[model samples]
Target: EIVAAVESVLAPQRAGRLAGRKVLVTAGPTHEPIDPVRYIANRSSGRQGFAIAAAAAEEGADVVLVSGPVSLADPPGVNVVRVETAREMMAAVESALPVDAAVMTAAVADWRTEADSGHKIKKDGSGRPPALVLVENPDILATLGHHPSARPKLLVGFAAETDDLIANARAKLDRKGCDWIVANDVNPETGNMGGAFNTVRIVSRAGIEEWPRLAKEDVARRLVGRIADHFAGA
Candidate 1:
């Protein structure tokens, strides 16, 4: 009762922090085709990205969610653009540019077939597996990070790693030229991927801030608070 009362009083103040601000978020896993019927994809579930969109909306930010294949419904009050491959995701990002902030949470594939077969590859009597030629996909985060005109004031990229999480995230921040990087250990043994909860760290030029394990929604809300504070200071 007391918590609700306090929240009710603070709600307006919180909501107004991001009023008139525009934000972009990318989520889920891009599927890169190998053939007409087969593709390669990652394990992202898009839960964290959806939660971030909801949190930004709660703070009164006009949010655009560019999503890969996921079963989740669109976050209320967010404009969602659904897509498949990494190239498609990049196009969507370009279309929604000139925002105050951008969050890249999508597990975009690193490589895709150079030329996808028109039809599914079939094995002949030789009984040998088909060989696939792969080419690197566009680096959406790096593109926005280094963009001259379309870069947002605040750019946040994510690094889901299996080992040396902090070091790798810091490296990613420097390499991608983003202001911040949210790093998490997504080892299947930890069940962070496709799981309800997450434990993560926020890496920036200032330093790293580690967070305890919590629901994906909680993480989103906290991140939104920081973003709001960032704008307040600006």
Candidate 2:
């Protein structure tokens, strides 16, 4: 009992398989500004990503959570960096680089206004709407996956698709050059986008491993366990 107590006191976080490892997580929905008053955003509540960060931290991993605009509280034992736009999120993710693993779960807007309007535009009684040119946002996951020197050892990407779920995930795994892709259906009917429960599948070179519908927290724990297994050569 004395020895155990002493060990616990000394290495409280070292009891898990991910001890001494660093993990990166990106979460929430990046808002791309159209004007000073409005921006393009998604329905992502950042629940799954936050849960993943918490799970990773619980497993003794040094977790860096680069989150977008979200109302979620910072997970205990995690270094949280909050950003509003996709560019900002990309910068934050890059700054936390050289991690052992990364999970890109943030729902980043695909495009943004080419230029932010300094002020909100008012209707001039014309029947036509304003024309806002848009440009593609930086692809954070693909950038890291194709990084020349700083790619994570185990890069994982998430695919939240409404259709062609497995096919899209497989394509993303190849296109993103990531080790694994976690695919889920967010077809509005599934309620997985901003809900507490999730159903996901692990898509990898090995094959697909489907998981039962579970609470977001449980999904996070199981995913972290899989990550630990991969590191431990299970």
> Which candidate ranks first by lDDT, i.e. highest?
2
Error of 2 at 181 (Å): 0.6
Alpha-carbon TM-score of each model against the true structure: 0.92, 0.94
Error of 1 at 226 (Å): 0.6
- How good is model 2 by TM-score? 0.94
What is candidate 2's lDDT per residue for 1-234, written digit by digit as tens?
999999887885566889989999999999988888988887699999999999999999999999998999999999999999999999999999889999999999989999999899777789788888999999999999999999999999999999999999999999999999999999998888889999999999999999999999999999999999999989
Quote the lDDT for 1 in model 2.
Answer: 100
Score residue 65 of candidate 1 by CA lDDT: 98
Give the distance in Å from residue 222's predicted Cα in candidate 1 to where it truly belongs: 0.3
**Model 1 lowest lDDT segment of ten:** 8-17
| Model 1 pairs in collision | none
Pairs in steric clash, model 2 = none
Model 2 lDDT, residue 24, Cα: 100
